[model samples]
Target: MAEQQRLLGGRYLLKEKVGTGGMATVFRAQDQVLNRAVAVKIMLPQYAGDPTFAARFKQEAQAAAALQSPYIVGVYDWGKDGDTYYIVMELLHGTDLKSGVRSHGALDPKKVAQIGSQICGALSIAHKHEIIHRDIKPQNIMVQPDGNIKVMDFGIARAKNSHLTQDNNVLGTAHYVSPEQTRGQELGPTSDIYSLGVVMYECATGRVPFDGDDAISVALKQVNELPVPPSQINANVDGDLERIILKCMEKDPANRFQTADELRQVLNSYLAGRAVDVPEPTRVIAGMAGAGGTEAMRMGDKTQTMVRPTAPGDTASNPVIRPNNQINTSSYDNEKHGMGKGKIAAIAIAIVAFVAIAIFAVSGFLNGGDQKSVPNLLGMGQEAAVASIKSSGFEPGNVNQSYNDQYSEGQVCEQTPDGGKTAAAGSKIDIVISKGPKPIDQVEVPDLSNASDLDEAKKIIENAGLTVGSTTQEANDADEGKIVDQSPKAGEKVDKGSKVDIVVSSGPETDSVPGVVGKTESDATNTLSNAGFSVNVESGGTSDTYAKGYVMKQSPTGTAKKGSTVTIYISEGKDTSSDEVDVDSLGLTGMTAEDAEEAIANAGLKYDPRQQSSSSVEVGNVIKYSPGGKQPAGTVIILYISTGPSE
Candidate 1:
């Protein structure tokens, strides 16, 4: 129960719970310092206590915080207080996609595409940073009151630099998982596209594509079954929209949209009523894996011939077609209708002659040909690798470059027919070069503490490639609207898009201690704290008017410095003749006469009660009392009770 009101980082005040999920509980909270409302998501105890889960949760939240996009839910702050880990995010007053669907089944196709497109926009940003949202489903998408979409829950997202998911332990909703995810294969942005496709399909058709009694069955269907098209479920679904959904749900990751940005472009085109280049539905041939599995209905009657490389260590005297006819090979039967003996001999002789020439050319034993083994070009710069290749009797062929996080830019990563392979002089060799780690902007933070104008300081910070974070107003000697202090201090090196908090001067603090008299001690302390003042509670002499535990007086009540300490005196009730009487004193002005008598008896005082007629007092309730101050432990005075209004 204490967790309900727990203050985190001395800033966020957790209020009533608003939501609960498998991983976290969300509460409506107040950012005390900012004096604004926020949503605080606290990890459940099970996850918070586990170091592995806690670290991953923190990393994901930090990654989300770094990403700034309108289509994505914003992460304000994240921190741990004692055993509880929490994340503060923008408090959205809208329903999740699931709730929307439940309330209004089968949304409009155009709206579905629009929502999917918005999510794709968010994904585009995340994917550019090499972050993949492993889980994308209706429940994780928030639909704002204004009909805008906000993609959420990157809790399972993993950066490209991190290792793959735990084998066989898929970390996503089964119904929306991609085939690769089900197979425990490597994942990329395409996986997210597939999940979004599922979401789009559900939004357009009022149900998930695959469903079963349990998660395992649903997962198997995701891996090995074709989903009924949205158009089939709901005839209102547009053909173009259905095509886009099918393309995103393609079984092979390679067949799906390569990037979220690509999907967004297609969606935009569809919304614009422009011609979209949607690929025709692919068919699953026998002994082949297609987007929708082997049993999927053929999209066309056209048969496609696919040539495959031989298996590793497959030994054969010659290429021969097996008789089961299970695989697609050459249609002609050369064995049944053989060539003449003279023709076969001639062909064999030609092959022998070619082999002899190739061997001799490589050995440089004939025709005065110079041949040498290729040099080790890997890890060398492109220019150096080319020079080495030329010096070793080989010419550098087409150079293919790709971004690599591990290799430096322009370094040779691979060479066809690799190093040490024998090649004739002046032979062309192809090499693959690294374009280096993806460029991430880093800049030195500009000093803004001395900036006199907040707007000007913000401009300067933006020029230095940083964003102005929350601005706090504090009382100081510096001019108002001027920066009094900053976080990541001036001259500190930080990420290019890092947010820096600044405190602006609101002028000298001339805070006056508020009147907390008659308030409970707890209420008084809270009042002082809210006023930017620290408070100390002290016991005050008993008062006849004030009740026990209530604030009677305070020190330095008129004017004091902001954040200055104040002492609040609490009432101990009326002073009594005996210590026992003081401890047993009771306030019975609001109590019924019977209740007052019972309290007096319990406090060891004699119960002397009498009835009185009064116009203002309620019937049988306490009206007046004698010896209002505490008396001897066994001493009692007259007690008057009202008997309705006087006649």
Candidate 2:
């Protein structure tokens, strides 16, 4: 059967498959009961047959449904129709972060921080629910059309108290897994934080920190290797953002941001242009020393070697230290035969110190001396600043521009180091030139009068640095779908990013008017009112074919403007023709204004008309009348007329 013909749980009508994963296939489905579009995820047949996997799938739905956050995908419902287990979720419409990053390389530092902050929000909610989102990579983050993000695919996530444990094997992708995850250890929120750090790293540098030909190699790197700083890969990555990302990627869980919320706060601070105070990432040295006694190592500027002490009866590896043509060990061996142990140790220390001093002397000679003080560059012209840096024994580095309130345009506003700070000679000095004070954040509202349709109007609004607000349709003389009016009218100045509301033309306000002949007065009025037409009632000549309170005639019965009046005439009940008709037996229970007028005329009595707005009475109809019974000839009857509902 076609997907459109397949109805699951007798309510969801599958429309078409939208996506597929290793464990389940997602279909865009229509909810029959709610009449809304939803995404239905059905487990693959292979996984559905396994009782253990099936149970976990069900738990995934339960745990995800318990989480409620705008940054988190909403889980509507879950169930099993026969052997098929399915979950209904909110249908999303946007590309994933991984695809976005691949198409467009590394993002701006602020944008990366913004995306990371939103993911942190989602993680914060999940952590509060005791659920750890083991996988937090770009592939699992959806970049929405509005530039926000939604964390997706909590497939492997489980609550803390869940019976199932994934400690036996690694569960997430190797390139983004934490060290503890690679070791199959118990995971927590910080583990997710570690993965998030890797995600931000990839976003900032356009590539994962660790990648290899196989998963095993990558997993090993996750445990044993340290990631290069993001700034080293992308020059745009600032020091603050680099620290934040590195802190989240710390190998030790305790060293990472303690919680997702804590990380979000720091990110928010960075985005707001406030000072961020994150500690430098901890650096660890792996495979430094082996078992047994410590080894002595000596490192020069160009060559270094570590010699392990030889132990008796130990046959591990060689203990001798050697560097090509740099050091001679034959002299030590020849002198050791007659020399005491103390003498040999003293000789080794002297050799190490001599190598260090020689290397230092060579470095000083090449660089033209010791450390030099960085010169003051603030408020100096770009050319002057560069000349000063050269004269001060330093090289000019990256020269960037930024808006600064104190410094004039083209003048240096900032430098990496203070004027008196000591830096190595010939080191590069980075400076920031001023672009003057920031401009006011205001924009002129776009004129939407010439827009052809709503879509065009939206584009115009957005192009003008404004957002589209609520749109309303109103009957207008302009062509249908055209924008007839706009708020904050054209050319008006407003704060940038303000919303502009628009009114769309619905064309002429004409509709088919229903025929109400021979219907009760109340029924006829209601029919007209519901059709967006007001009703007006008038007395009609007596007619034997229709009852007293029934409509006998109507005007403009076909099409008419909405909210316009439709006139209806009611019968006077068989034209009694008696000069003094008995008012008590007049049968005017539901008589319209027209019916009442004819009846009063037939009974030889005059009526005075009175009109007022009413809520319970239809327009142009009679509400009530005085002189109900036993009225004499020429008696003036007061007839109350309804003028429709009040505003």
Best by lDDT: 2
- Clashing residue pairs in all predictions, respectively, total 1, 2
- After superposing candidate 1, which stretches have Cα over 4 Å from the reference? 163-168, 285-647
- Taking all chains together, the TM-score of candidate 2 against the true structure is 0.51
Show pairs that collide, candidate 1.
251-291
lDDT of 2 by residue, 505-592 (tens): 8786688999999999999999999988989999987998998999999988788877789999999888655545466566553467
How far residue 199's Cα lies from its native spot in candidate 1, in Å, is 0.3
Please state the error at residue 103 of candidate 2 in Å. Answer: 0.7
- Rate residue 4 of model 2 by lDDT: 60
- All candidates' lDDT scores? 0.79, 0.83
What does candidate 1's lDDT look like per residue over 607-634, in tens digits?
A: 6788888888888888877776756778
TM-score of 1: 0.47
Q: What residue runs in model 2 are displaced by over 4 Å at the alpha carbon?
A: 2-4, 166-168, 285-647
Worst 10 residues of 2 by lDDT: 289-298
